[model samples]
Target chain A: MSKKRIIAVSMVLAMLLTGCGSTAATANGTEEAKVEQVGQDTTSAAEEKSSDGEVITLTWLNHYAEAGKQAWVQSVKEQFEAKYDNVVLNIETVDADSHKTILQTKLASDDAPTIFDLSSNADLQVYNEAGYLADLSDFECLANVDAGLLKEGQVDGKQVGIPIELSGYGIFYNVDMFNEYGLEEPTTLSELKNVCETLKANGITPFATPFAEAWAFSCYPRVLYDAVCWNNDGAFWEKLADRSLKFADCEDFKKQMQTVWDFHEYWGEDAFGTSWDSAQQIMANGEAAMIAHGSWAVDGITSYNPDINLGVFPMPVSEDPSECRMIKEPGQQLVLFNYQDERIMEAARNLYNLIYSQDCMRVYAEEAHQMPSVPGDYNILPALAEIVNYPAELSFSEAGLKRNDPEHEDVLFETMMNAYTGSTFDVNELVDALDTAFDNIKK
Target chain B: MRKIRISSLLYILLMLLAICIFIMPVALAVLTSFKSKPELAKSILSLPATWNLDNYKGAVERSDFLNSLKNTVAVVAPSVVIIVLCSSMSGYTVARHSRDSRALRLLDKVYLASLMIPFQILMIPVYKIYKSLHLLNTLHGMIFMLVGTSIAYSSFLYVGFVKGIPHEIEESAYMDGCSEFRCFWLITFPLLKAISATVAALHTMWLWNDFNIAVILLQKENVRTITIKQFYFFGKYTADYGMAFAAAILSMIPVVACFMFMQKYIVNGIVVGAVKS
Candidate 1:
């Protein structure tokens, strides 16, 4: 071979070897770096303070990027900084859609946020099991929180997080349209049916389903699931969790599935194609009398028409009005990562306490338009009057079920979707599917 | 003459249809971004009553567009340069040695195989690897993954282009006592410019529009890319879609600017990478 060929071949050989070498180096480098991080953490654990008066920065990751919530978080940051001259609060927010994955990744990494938002119920349970949470059982802020509300925030009988706000799921009706049609808020299944019939007769859509999105479509079924299954002494979820019960065994589930069918019939012609925001528009514009949604959607509707006279009411799925109860869940909560530094832990707790104080809760209630977890009186939005007055029940949220079986929520959501839309959906078939899926999940 | 005119007319019509199909969604977003919330609720497809810039202002303020733009450029520029350098060298080797040795042939085969492995399959493993390496939340970490994920296809292109070059040029250079490194750089590299340009343009497009790698690797507010910024912006303003649309449109500007800047090289690169090989 010519000299050029030899030169070219040697260059190729060297370049190819470098590629292979770098990958092995990357893997070995990874293991070594992790060991180094552990060493650093150990050495730094005892040195929590930054000399005498140097500012110690605490990083907080949250999902409250919404307009009003952002202000509330900013207020907390300002107050926390004001109280502790030696500390600075650094805030970062990721959107809710990707928050869980991003937060989980950060928690497993060395750079976990000092404070973060813990999704209520099962999400909290997962992190608690991993020892990623700082036990806030002795945190003073929990003292002022209503006992029942505080109890809901607990996992393994330990208070792991502080509820930022509480909200419930129900029907948001156009009050002007209801009054124009001389309709009273329905208190029973027959009454709801009659109301729908009357609205239909008046050339108005009784319900705007927002079935284009599966989660929104699942809202009514979820609320109905609470009323029917939850009224059976609240033991249904525990039985499901322990594998002693199956969805097929619940007679009330089938009855509620029929209400799912009724919701489908009442859904407007464009329901399958209309989005959640558009459905709110339909309700706000008085084209639809009601939308089955949660408290968060009140702002969504009011944004479209600021003067939209909206009111909330429980979906009367059962014949007996006494069985009706709105499904409530604590919205967002402040939770701390298990940090080794005592000073950092103290700073995070101080911030948490400041954020949930009665003064701050009042601002949160007024500004966020979300109900306070603490029982002291605050200005409640008129739209929430019906939900606040109605009998409320804490249902087995899918997130709670998901902690036991990761696939349970997916299987349930799919089943609900199929039940709502599938022409040949049988309750028995649905129940069998649910049972089979639950067993598979357990396996 | 009539037949040629008619054929030309048909081509123009076809191009127009393609353009319309591609541009309709972008145009809709632009139109919707100009509308108020009430107007959007009234009709999504209708022209705005007032052509307002409130959505754009809100999106710019909320998404922290300037900081994200700086971060995106910081990540993309260095990463693209690294990808081009590594892939060109590797591609040169694979193309020349594939016929001579099984090891080089196997190396080339691996590059081809890497192309088949989807990014999603590697997402978790990569995250774990990144975490262990202390590479999480850093622009350097993002740059590393972007270059790693892109090198295989780009090297594949380089290898093909390198193969077609006459070995006589490098052979003669070696006869004059030029070292392998010197000969490859002075002679072979200059010859590989067309393909190198192609590789740079192609990977720039890939890295510029990427969300998954950046989303997984970069978590800090100071290091966020435009795609993740827009994702968070839309999440924040889901109830206010006019503002979300404005943010979406703003995010598209950088990618479009990149394509426009690389347009000449891109068209040539696509042709050369596709047909010349």
Candidate 2:
């Protein structure tokens, strides 16, 4: 009787599973088929003007899923659809890690996103070498952007991407602390050191340099590079890769690095166990006067103390105020794959025109809470409002791409931290270690 | 008798300590979930300054929590049942016939060998094949890949458990004029319940939290599972730890409930299998 009951139960369960599986499978198949038909429709849609009264869907795969960005994208989508009734701009946002994973296949396939950016500036070389990036040098929509600003996203002197927004890395200082100490924002290295001395005298740490985390500390090298080698393009990186240059031999690179000795003296001693969050805590809670971080640090600081009066400035690397520059990189680049269908490519270009339009640029700037990338009268970050204007004469220094020696980046960062955390700092030793590590990488 | 009681009490206390050690992070997550951003920054370990539903509201609106939940159930439920049923049949046949049939023996060896190869090695190749089959961006396709990738290891589990079971039970059923299908399902399968429950529970948890293959295959918004949705959730919203934790707890409730319920059967199965062997 027990055996009969077990058989009966098993049969019923099997029958139920089969029924559920078929219903779900059929529904999934219908979804898949419908999506395929849309792909075919987009391919067959009208080219350029969308003159045949068919909708051309431009699929854009991006990784900027921030709430502000989503709002801005939606605004652009509505404006774009209103302007061009025949063209539909479809956008999908994935995370950076997964975007990079999907792009491994998507970039090479013919069915790639109509508009998307490469994961890194270094990838411009790889994707360009593969002929996967569309050269938009002749794009009339991109004509308003300064040639120099657009050059950061280029490879082999062909414009491959338009810089969307800027991520400025600099000194995030406590405004209230500076005011209480009667310290004006420092614009040169000597003044910065004096400010550090005043903060130290007042029993506050000056810099939360985060030596415990190599990636957080890694941005310090860019600070030195920004001071000495602003706008060298990818020349410095390619030289380092091809045995043409060594860090010790690069004079400008070595010139600004001596300031790190002061950094080590001020903050490196107790920073061995500090993380980015702890460093932010130190700044927000008034334990530290400033942090060697970027514009993105504001959110973390505000989360700690909503009323924390904080400001950003270009970390002065030399005595001359005129030469001071923010260490800068693109927050994201707007790009299209060359492998996509031509009609879809044209539709994406039209959408780009609207995205870079003055109205849309203002929206993008306000959402990013940063200065406008292109030349425009727009709202700027209040923290950055004092010392800078749109397209300030003081420029930005883009990091040299480590094309072949990618892992050597961590080696470089770890070496910097390792040098700074020592009892005494030596600039030459740090630079020598960097050169040795770079040389050791198999080209 | 007093010494014995004392030792037993100590053992139970140690087990309770072990449970607390494991549960600390979860307790912290629940605490942090109720916090606002300021409260989170003030202290991650302490209670929220003011309990509110705002973080949960933001997580729901942003993550499409319910739709992803529906999709997760759609993918995991059918996949687990199919894996259990098919692997059990294959395991039983191979366990019974491998010595007599060279093909069956080779098939068993191949399944065992395939377990050693990592998914990273197969990821790109599977992706390319899926693309050619127009299986990209489809939940059913993802389901197919999940079932196919999981079968080899699942079958290997069943094969070991079946070999340990007495064959005379099935042999007697066949001799009593019962069909081979009835003999296995009615007589042998009921006896194999402990191991079957273990496999079902293990695969259910795994398929719930699967990210890699799901990330690659389920690229469309309408088809995304909860894990993939959370990947995008934490991408740029990580600054607001209160909201991040809220989103985490919301997504975790179902899977944690699942694990808690399945955990008892899993432990019992393991112990019963050990005793029988």
Candidate 3:
């Protein structure tokens, strides 16, 4: 009796599963039919271009917060749409770190957006090599943009991406706190050390650093490496780029690593565990005297405490005090993908032009509080203007594209991070690890 | 009498210590939510010097708290119900029926084997299947996926429980000229109430707080569930932890309330299912 009952139940389950499979098969058939219809429509539209409406939709992928006060994106979108009635804009916002991962996945799947943001020149190079982005050299908008900024977006001889904004990373100090402690902004490595000692004597943590995420410490070594190793020489990057020079062989690179290792004494005891948010809070609460980050923090600080007085200074150099080469890069770039529709391409160009226009630059500067790539005298907040005018390098130094190959570049910093945080590894071991990793990538 | 009182006091102290260990983080989140961004930076663990409800208000407004609450309920409720019904029926059949056919035995083995396969490997394929069906960003589609994945394991538990139920009870119902469906629904299902309740509670918690599928399938703002909404509140460059904590607190309320109400059934279901052959 039990055997017969089991047979009956098994039959029921089999029938249910079969039903599900057929339903899924029908769904696939419908999807295929839709794809065919879309292909046919595209062909017919091409033949009768004059008769069909010329409106085009450009899909933009960016990493911007969509929550309250999205004035930055909204202003740009509105200006573009108002100028070109036939253009439709679709923007997809994602987290900055996740954007690269998602963009790579989308590219592999062949669902790439028409325009997307690229973080580094090496990233621009990778996609350009893949034939995934459009060449912007022919575009008339390139005339007004700086040649140096354009060079950051070029792969080989072709311009593949457009610079949107520029930023400088260095130490931003609380001027009021510095005044209270009777200390001036440090101009050299030794002076900076003395100031740190003075701050520590006054029961204050001198520098706020968060090693929990590990990436925050990357900025320290990058600034130091640029000051010591490159010193505004283009040959340094050229050699590093083609793999002729190893970062470990450079004496300045070692000194830079040692400088970052010395920061452990000035940082919080549990700095390795403190997140960026907590570290920022520590500085905001006046527990720490200085924050070493990019100018992006200007808005974040003002938004948190409107009354707090802030000052910006270049990262101290080891050799020539006057040669303060601040590490600067375009905040991000917008790259267009290949689309057959001429109208879509035209609309994208129009939108691109509107964003770079002087009028839009003022709004972008005020709202986003970021340095506009285009040269214009716009009224910016006093504190922001001060940082904008701070003596800084506007071109890619040793730390820009040359140090940004995803496969080879990441190991040097990762090893440095481990070494700096009291990991018992000799300098030779660190150098060997970096050389081995870079050599493997060359293969 | 004094010695007995002293022992009771010691037991109470131990319990209090455990509660504190568990409750401190949650208490800090709540307190931080009431602080200004600057104040929060000063003392993340300390009580607020000034009470502020702005973070909670901001979190709710930014996350679209009401709409997400509705979407979560719509997906989780139907999924919980469908899984309970399907698993109970399948479990009842497997438990009561002892079949000899090779196909029948193979099907039983497949059901048990599927429980071992991790869901991560299946996520992409499952998403492609749903996309083809035009069900990628819909609440119904999400609920359907959850129910399908859940039925296998829930049915396994039901199968064991149903076997322990006496065969005579269902046999008597069958002898009364009742249909197999009616006999199972009227006689067998009532006896498996404790098991059903357990499945419902477990599935309710799982489906309600699920973040993985919600992120993969739903892209539209109107259809996003609570977990996805919480993620949207914090972008890459900026994250308001106070608001994130508020959203976390809000998402837990429904599940916690359900567990509170159904504590007895959940306990009984686990105890009986464990002891059964």
Candidate 4:
């Protein structure tokens, strides 16, 4: 009797299951069909402009979602939409880490944003190689930007981006500490070491590297590569790319690595575990005398402690002070995606031009508090005076050769930390490992 | 009696230590959120000189707190309901027919396979598919993706739940000339209250705390989830830790509240879902 009952129950359950399965399949089919229709409608709608009595929304993507930057973007959106009655501006700001993947995916799809932020020279070249960047050589704003600065945004001599801001990186020193010690700003490698010894004797940490945040320490090697290594040979990058010149073969590379070792030696005890936020706070509170970072450090330090008196000087990476140069780069650049749609491309171009307008540039500079890349009668902030006037070298952080081995930066950082952590650190072995990694990446 | 008292004292001490270990970070975050930037620079570990409300105010304004809360609820509610309803039904069917039908066995294996696959691998393809379907940046689209991703695990829980339930109860209903549809709604579903609660509570928390899918699919600020909004507090060059902590505390309110309300159900549900599955 129990067996018979079980058989009956299974039969009823099977019947119920079959019936429900068909219903769900039908419902899903209907959903797909409706979504397909919506997709078709939007694709057709994108082709139709406001001239045809339809509002066209152009999407722009960026990674700057900070408080002040977001406010500036909102203002820009309002002003742009008001100027063009028919064009609705939609600006989407993703976090910087996720922005690259999101943009790459979107570009491959039909939903690509009209304008986006380009990360680095290497990233720009990748996009350019894919033919994804819209040629903006004829953009009106190009003429207003400094020629040297404008060249940074160019890929293969075809202008594909517009410089939005420019920043220079150097060693930010505590002006109060320097005055207390009666130490003039160091200009040469020997002078830098003497200053470190003075600070050590005075019972202050000479430098703060924040090795835990690998990218924070990466700027040291990046600037060192540009100033000490690449400065000697103009064709070094090309040779490295062709595999004829290895990282191990360069004498200057080893010297740069030695400077990194010295930096680790002078940094605070907990530098290996210090985070950016903690490091900035330490710098602001005068626990550390100097940090090798860029102009952006000023805002963070001041925000942490408004009364922080800070000064900037080029990092002495060479024996001769004359060879030392502050590493500068365009802070951010705006690029237009190749949408293959005439109306959309035209609207994007118009929006790009408007972004570089005098009023817009003023708002951007004021809100971001960074140096303006475009030509304008903008007042230089009092804090930027020391580094802005100094001789600068174009930063290679994003340049293809410097970014070849993705692991090279982190490995260099680890080697520096190991030197300070009682490890048998071998500079030659480190260079060989980087060269191997580069060769593997090339293959 | 003396020995029991001594043991109880030792247990109390251990419990207190456990409580402190768990609560210290959260307490620190709360304390840190109330500190001014200068005060934080002076000492991150010390109690604030003054209980500052400015960080909370700034965090709220910068994150668009009210809108993000609304958006989060709007996404989580529909997504959870859809996942529970569809997955429960599928689980019931597959579990009941598993013995007699190879098709159901195949379906069960497929779902089990899907559970092993990680979301990171599917993220790119999912984005492309959503874009093609015109689902990007839409609340409904987000709901759709969340439901699809969650169903496999949810159904697995439901399958175990349905199998544990005696078929005798449903058999009696069937003998009364009741339809299978009526039997499920009237008899089986009512008995599934425990597992349904588990599924609902689990998915609610998952959808609430989800960051990746929300960031990738929902690009517009107005449609962003609370997790995505919290990212805005951290800048590339500078981070406002006070404001970030404040925003974090704010985002936690709903999830904590949901858990508190479903505390009893969650405990029982997890136990039942785990042991039976």
| Count of backbone clashes, every candidate in sequence | 1, 0, 3, 0
- Candidate ordering by DockQ (highest first): 4, 3, 1, 2
Top TM-score: which candidate number?
4
lDDT by residue for model 1 (A1-443), tens: 69979998999999778544322112211221222222124212122356565566787788776776777778888888788888878777777766666665544334567778765566677666656677899888888875656655688878887777677788889888889989998889899999999999989999988888877876778778776676554666667766798777788888788677765668889766888878877877778888888887787787788888888887787788877777666666777777666777787778777877888877777776677777657776787655555543523232222233345767777876766565555777878877887777778
Roughly what TM-score does model 4 have, to 2 decimal places? 0.88
User: Where is model 1 chain B poorest over a 10-residue stretch in terms of lDDT?
Assistant: B230-239
Clashing pairs in 1: A4-B171
lDDT of 1 by residue, B8-123 (tens): 99999999999999999989999988998888888888999989899999888877888888888898889888988898889888877778888889888889999999775566
Looking at model 4, give its docking quality level: acceptable
Comparing 3 and 4 on DockQ, the stronger one = 4
Against the unseen true structure, what C-alpha lDDT does each candidate score? 0.74, 0.72, 0.71, 0.76
Candidate whose lDDT is highest: 4
Q: For candidate 4, lDDT tens digit of each residue in B1-277? A: 9999999999999999999999999999999899988888989789999897999999899889999899999999999999988988898998888999988998999999998887765665677688668888899999998999999999998888888888999999999989888988899888778888888888889899999889888987888889998878777888788999999998888888887888788778667766763
Model 4 CA deviation exceeding 4 Å by range: A1-54, A375-377, A392-424, B1-3
| TM-score for all models, in order of appearance | 0.86, 0.86, 0.85, 0.88
List per-candidate RMSD values in Å.
6.1, 8.9, 6.4, 7.3
- Residue-wise C-alpha lDDT for candidate 4, range A1-443, written one tens digit per residue: 99989998999999788544321101111121111111222233234455569677777788887777887788889988898877888888988777766775565444557778875566567666656578899888787776667766778879887778777778888998999999988888889999999998998889876667767766656667766666666566657766789978898888787677766668888876888888888898888899888788887888888888888887887677777777667767888766666777677777877888878777766676677777577664555655556543523332223333344445545655555455446678777866775576568
Rank candidates, lDDT, best first. Answer: 4, 1, 2, 3
Give the lowest summed-lDDT range of ten residues in model 3 chain A.
A28-37
In candidate 2, what are the lDDT values of residues A125-189, reduced to their tens digit? 65565555688887777776644457667788787878776666788889999999999888888
Q: How well is candidate 4 docked (DockQ)?
A: 0.35
lDDT of 1: 0.74
Give the alpha carbon lDDT tens digit for every residue of B1-277 in model 2: 9999999999999999999999999889888778876666556688877788898898887878889889999999899999989999998998889999988999999899999987765665576578778898887898899999899988888888888888888888888999999988898888878778888888888999899888878877888888877754443423556667788888778877877877877877666544535
